[model samples]
Target: MHTFGSRRDIDGLRALAVIPVVLFHFGFSTFSGGFVGVDVFFVISGFLITGILFREINAQRFSFVDFWARRARRIIPALSVVLVAALALGWLLLTAKDFSELGRAVRYQALFISNILFMRQDGYFEPASDLKPLLHTWSLAVEEQYYIFFPLLMMLLMRHVRHWRWLLFAMLLVSFGLNIAYLERKPDLVFFSLPTRAWELLCGAMLAVLPASKQAVKPWLYQVAGVVGLVAVLVAVFTFDENTVFPGWAALLPVLGASALIWSGAQGSTWVAQVLGTRALVWIGLLSYSLYLWHWPVYVYANAISIDGIQHWEAAGWMLLALGLAWSSWRFVELPFREKRVLAGRKPVLVGGLLAMFALAVTGAVVRSADGFPQRLTGKALEYAQARDWRAGQMKCMLVTSDKNLDKACLVGANQGEPATQLFWGDSHAAALLPAIENNAARQGRPVWLYSMSACPPILSDEPRQRCKDFNQRTMEQIRRLQIKDVVLASNWSLYVYGREDGDRKVLLNPRDNAAEAEARMAAALKARVAAIRATGAQVWLFKEVPLQRKGTISRLTSLARVGRSAEGLGRPLQEHLARQGFLSALFASMSAADPGVHVIDPTPLMCAGQVCSIEVNGHSLYRDEDHLSDIGSARLSPLFAPVLLGTSDN
Candidate 1:
């Protein structure tokens, strides 16, 4: 085997990459952009791996089997231990549905495709992502995938192609271009996929293959480069937040910074390098891989058991625990395999790694097939676990922007052929109310037309997607053609006005607009929409949004129940709900007062009382997720719509 002398500065750089990530995941506001650390790691990996591959291939000593075995030895053992530990903890703590999801995660992760699975599930910055024990593994999957194909590509280029460095550079540029191009349209895809993320690693690769200088380099130049690179990385770590469009142009900050640092250190040590090469930083850097692996699951499970969210002091304690676990994992698991003290033979390590992955995959499959062992819970816990299930026909009824066929809208209540006197129109929140509306309409002998779409409000506004604009127009035309007498406007109103708790502002009425501006726009748009429908001689029944529970609160319903803990206080404060909805409440009131034909329906009375907007009633959760009502929760709102459906006074 060939060896490159260890760079203590590089080890210190690893510490730089990991500390921010750990602090960020543990809810440290100071390390808001700590996620950029992953990008730094990518660059380091690309440089180091490419360095080894370039030298070996040039020497005609590169063996694919040997290279893969080394990689397996470095990665598999610690990873397997973490996976097993996560599954064990999940079984004890996770709800059946959550456990099932974890099982699915395990299956995909075993195949190094967890990034794909996560891309389809949740954005990395989403509040719910904190619950996923394996979420951090997406970065690992990206690295492993790069390892699988990159060495071969390097060999091909070295053996067959002249000017291989330029080819590698071109590939890097292409990947970066893809990342920037797709960031707006498919942010999640760009964030998780190897195609878009490859450039960061390739940046390091480019550094590796660059010709070494023959003459002595100036110390001043190295010092300047190192300082600038360190500053860039630190700036990104502090200034960037969840709202940043990542792995795009913004990603260049950390990626290039890390590359610069690596390049600077290649010649001779500078003051910046000396600072990085400190004993404490070097020790952390040595444990960086293990620390990264252990920290996320530790944070996830720690948050899972907490009644309220994890406090800062609690987070600090948990972080220390994660550090301890990481140290143990590095000491006992990572070092043994990496040093060839265990699974010493190449074939044994390779075969053993494959077998372990297969075994874990099979175990995941069994857990999934058995539905996460639902028999583990009983009574209220079981009920809460099942609460996430949407109403049976919701997917069919709630159209997406792409679904253009208005005729495909699900008809509900009375006979199918009956002329619908009432219409339910809005977004997914409206669809959640279908069960209540259908039951009430049936009792009142009134058929209702449903024209609901996901993320599309009932208001007429060009600010939303063009598809939404078209959907609203077609629905308006339908209301006119059918001579509908009543229209119910329902949506998660706060979502459009304030966006998600995780700083996702894209769903706002005008994502570019300020909060006050968005509120004003929403008010004007909603009023215009209501007046337009009223002008057509149809009464507008405006349903206010249900109380949105605190982030991760809904999932806690089942998790708390799983451990036989009372979920009595697991709800958002009524005052907090009122404060969030204050603008909408005032708007609805003004609209109703201005035009008696428009009636306001407030869910607060039904869903909240005594300064608390409870998520549960009689051991059953009212919410399916954070905001949307479950079927049972929706049925609870039957009385609110009963009078309108029956064409009687609400009193």
Candidate 2:
């Protein structure tokens, strides 16, 4: 049903696509643009698949069933092996919450809707992506989805349209146009969806369907084309990064480059063909698909288990292991299915594939429904696993990005005819203190107003976050409108000063400056916010952020404890925390010293004892997911708020 003959150069192309992708995922800085490898793969797939369809359709021998069966045999066997291995390993290594999330991912992968699932969740480049073992499967989902519709669409065009090239070109233009249009506003959609990505494949299809010229071209021209194409791919692999607006016009570099190499190879002998036709390159290319399937999960689980995170050397070792796994999978799983050695008959192979897929889906559903099978954890691990639940009612209290209906409904304290005397303002960190504030206010017999927005710092700058500046302005007005006398300001201040896990960063004062300048700008913004609070006739109490736990605090601690091991030296050093917060701390102290109306309440001393901050204290977990305090942890801060709420000096 599908044959491209022996194109060793194409095999080399596969090597080109897989190596950089593996390198990039392994965290090699040199391969920053290595993610473009996916685009390269798309081009090669489009070319090869389109060529097969074209040949079969023209010969009047095309059968959708055979094509699909071939695809299933090629893809499913190794995929099933990897998925099963991941599930088994996940049962052992992942925390209950993470394992449950993995279950959801597995379900999506089985349904071949992982791309849509990922698009609806975080972007692929997000740091949390490292945790998802099935994250790489999104690309497979996209490719599968494309093949589902593409052959049918091509058949229709071939039957109806006199000139299919114009139709293909038109479709390409629409997809490319849509990609450009949605690049800024809907980047995730563009990145994950088939519509925006189809053009890259179409670029190869256009090449495949073009009439080959009989006239001989100069060898140097082919050489130049191959060189330029190779350079384009290399440049994109090195130059592009997580910050790049991808799959837009920027994708042209690798897409066109891949197209050029294919064209140059088809024309005759070129330097690229000579280079790509090497035995070693072709072998790696043969292993590329299996390699791609195995690499990400290997990296994900490896990183998950490492206490300090994977180093470059460790990553290299993992890469070697991935290569070994790829070879074994290719030799044992993929080849057996492809050659019909194991599932010999077509009906048997298809049935086996269907059953395998169904079993994986059922397993995934069970895992998800069972809440990642929490029974796997016991004693201390179970206690710590349950600690991740933050009972602060985040969606109700925190202002989401699209929130326009600003209702003062997030009131958290005493309510029996008592006016709201205390107000809390900041980001999600401020929201974490809700339990403590509610406890303290209930004891003091006072009502507290709680308002917060996630990832939006309480800085009064022209920060261009989604509704951040506007939200802060409205919050200030609300403070004055309510005539609140005591206002508490808190946030993950270091996050704003530094950046988030994803590459997205907050620009404090000046967008066109260094980190030191940004820190200065942030300090000034804090002072301005403080002045605004003072102007509202409110005593501003600056609540210092809690000590950050670096690894998955409670989860890591619990997982290790289950096996009679401890996550020692896992929490961030107290000195490192202090260093990150030094500027903010100084500003808070100076502001407090300058005005009687301003004060500072430090949570660090309470949370951290000497050298290290504790994830758990005396059998109770202090922190939740890496940095946020648990409900129990938040409750422990009740004493700090009591004096401030009672109109007594915290000092």
Candidate 3:
């Protein structure tokens, strides 16, 4: 039976794993690939935990009870405290929807299945994930889940297989192969699922089972291996970004690097080990587990409060705060529980851990059942909170991806028996203008058919989004069949021309085309679409895209109002909005000049007052969330629509 001594370098390695993650979460652009720290941690965990299991199994002293008890004591206490804290703070800060989501997260996290829950939601690195306080727990959940199955698998191998290392190597290859196979098709599953992640853990397990004497035979080899491993981890940290497809082939760098570092430090000391064993790195490493737990929640809360996003210096302050919390959690909660001072007996500690987890799960369920217990908010807080419900009751009119018949349910202006004279065709923006069209068309005694879909451009372009193509084709068929005369085209045009405001930085046309070429394609498509509409004897009315609110107007306004803060600078600048409109504006001008059937309707003049687009006009929010109009905002445009559709004045 072989027993391993504690390595200070391993603790320093923990520091290396955590610092980059903290820096990355804190929004430091320099550490874009700092997310690889989690991969490093995974390898370290596999090495240490496997080493313990291997040693115990060889000595014939391996106890599932004892192993689980140790895991419970190590993981449960600090986690419970963090959960309680998150519950308390979330109640105070989070909106009802956010709080409800938090409740769901809390339940999933308590069960140690948050990885599964998050898999169905946003990508880990997405901006939307920034606000989720419990997001980091997914990794802990993955590790704990591995611990549950790995020890049993290892014991079985020890009992039957004479060459157990070969089985481990084979399992590693299988898991790696599985990850590679589904890398592109199911990247999220590869990222969050245990099946694909098992290879990373097994990489460390392979190193642990190897003979220590064999590893220490050549001191120069350890030095070289350790240095190369350190460089590999650092390279992954510096070079990787959100665009990089991960954990298939890309994960090899950090996993192998961490394995090299662990193997080199097994017996003989390398130069990398000496550097890692320094007091500063070792101290940080000692607090690494607790630090990892605390940092993300701190960053999340900081982001939730700050409108523009947490500044670098403010993020530093939050990091310091996390450090203090980590130190306190480690010193008070973790150390005592680990040393058995809090729950002295193994059975007692195990019971206490189970009870605590159960209590947290119960609390989470209650929070969810109570619909986030919205009674915490009152008056203006409640008003702003409720403002987030910005759907504008138009879902029935918007043609979903699954919807087949365009004529069946998408009419907006009049009853089914009335022949539709006007057609509104575009994306969600066209749906947003439905209320005004309904009111105006009723006054004119003419039905207006609304056929719209979300994230679909109205243009007949060679863009790769087939859903848009299918919807537009069906809409054109309906227009020709009904002989619809007045056709209004509206869309969030910037998204197709310049990419999404929140997601992609710029538009991408084809794999081969540049931005200019893509713009040309968009312009040509618009012209062709206009000519086709004119051929059907329809006068095309193109509504200018609404000014986008950079800061989420309603949510931001609500958050600010809840704290008695003024939302003076919450709206997007008119100059920026106009600049984004430059290309579209020019295109519309050229189209109107060339075709007598085409008319441009500019909402910019009415929407923007002075140099700013007012998010709130006359105590009513002009925006529902960011870009889409609220019921009030849409109704306000009814007078504008009256003149165009009914050929009558507002009076």
Candidate 4:
């Protein structure tokens, strides 16, 4: 069995893994599977470490203390320096909350268990996962978890079996089976947990079990297979995305590919391995650990600070700069302390190192509290977080879940003096119109009944009616039973009016139509629903859909004022990046036809000046989250209710 890693190949592998991960982070269109580099590392680590275990057991020289000590020596000095440096640098650039989260990440990193920490933090595969600076540490945690149990398992297995091959095969089978099962039933657990990851390591162990004669097999066939393996992994990296279920059967392409290259055992003689396992590449690989540690934090910090996606060429420059920083850290901080002669193998140094790591971790967590770092400059970040509450009671909603539906709670204004009130009903986007609904009710001096459900449009179900049937029934029952006089129907009309024809589920998350079918369906649905709802005896006031806004209303106002656009509070018309998209425009094209009961309250004046929709009014957030308006933003409806709800207003 191999006792030590071929430093050149190992380094080459490191180079391969880190490059794609870095490129992907910079938002490169290619190398989506660059993330598989982590898997490659896992396989390499498993093979090398398992090989080490096999040699020690065969020679009877294995000692757990010494093994763990070597691990501490190899992992801690460089890791500690990176964490502390990241924390210090992060303090300068990060917001209070970002700093706070950085602190928590640092602490968990110190213990080598950040995967579990993060899984519980923002959810496993959320879009927000991109924001985490220390996310890469999950791989280290997985390695540490394996290290904790692997040596003992090796010791026990050696006692039970004389030949190591049988034992390795059994362990491989167990780990692989666990991975397959977890991938299907619990992918998140598989993503973060070590049990699911052990199989990758076992693949390496399997490599070590092969006899030396087998390793030296006819070189050309080995050369061909090894090259094929590496290419397969690269192809997978180039094509795959985060949405792919990883470490599953699909992962076999990359893992087995790496394993095949390893099993080929090129030994620097084979032409392909010679170029791949070159001194320069290996040298870069030797520093790959440090590079991996530094690259992610730099990218995350850039994103947190940038106003938008960093332009492509600008991100490329960051990669070069990150390489420089990593090389410097490796040369200056890691090499000197790692040597055995300087510290004389004393135990206190380890203790000191552990304590120092723990300290940095603590600093990361505390630095993001309400009064944490930069909060002294920006007041309390927690207080700024309070801005979400600005639109709280002022607007009533059907579901507190999504802005796409109207929630019953937001129409509180409609409950003004009267015990009984009018009922408002529609899909999620209807929530945005609640400010106007409540305003009109308050003017009428009566309460308004509230009913809202996500994706439950008021229109009768069309063609395929599989989902939300019971929800529609419940909504219909409530509308008929309530002593309701008026119904305000508002929605992301583009979603319903332009339904899908290809497949039932809407592939796009937003309300816009990308293809011909969605646009057509969106318009047809709006027309039919408005006409049908108006058919009811109730007075139907259709609030023309509100424009979807982004950016904080306050920040936009602040920016406009800085440019003197808001000099008289008349900011230059906000850019029309997105107009009232899809069906809302089509509905408006044929909508205004002097219908008395079917009144359409359009916020075109408040939202659009000329043709652009502004996200801010009076330096406030227009939408609380995504395209939905904030509590203060709902006040934009005040104008629509001028003659209907309140005497004067803004929507």
Judged by TM-score, which candidate is best? 3
Give me candidate 2's TM-score against the actual structure: 0.84
What would the TM-scores of all predictions be? 0.85, 0.84, 0.89, 0.78
The true-versus-predicted C-alpha distance at residue 63 of model 4, in Å, is: 1.9
In model 3, the runs with Cα more than 4 Å from the true position are 1-3, 214-216, 390-392, 401-404, 408-423, 436-485, 496-521, 548-557, 571-583, 605-621, 636-643, 646-651
Against the correct fold, how does model 4 do in TM-score?
Answer: 0.78
Per-residue lDDT value at 343 in model 4 = 46
Greater lDDT among 1 and 3 belongs to 1
Off by over 4 Å in 4: 1-6, 85-104, 120-126, 266-268, 341-346, 360-384, 391-415, 418-485, 491-536, 542-619, 641-651
Task: In model 2, state the lDDT of residue 542.
Answer: 91
What does candidate 2's lDDT look like per residue over 23-61, in tens digits? 999999899999999999999999988998898898989
Cα lDDT, all candidates: 0.89, 0.84, 0.82, 0.64
Where does candidate 3 clash, by residue pair?
none
Predictions ranked by lDDT, top down?
1, 2, 3, 4
lDDT of 3 by residue, 494-594 (tens): 76766665455334445345568767887988888888888888788888888987643455555555666655555678999999999989999999998
The lowest-lDDT stretch of 10 consecutive residues in candidate 3 is 642-651
* Clashing residue pair totals per candidate (backbone < 3 A): 0, 0, 0, 46
Number of the predicted model whose lDDT against the real structure is largest: 1
What clash count does candidate 2 reach?
0
Which residue pairs in model 2 clash with each other?
none
**Quick one: ranking by TM-score, best first?**
3, 1, 2, 4
Worst 10 residues of 1 by lDDT: 642-651
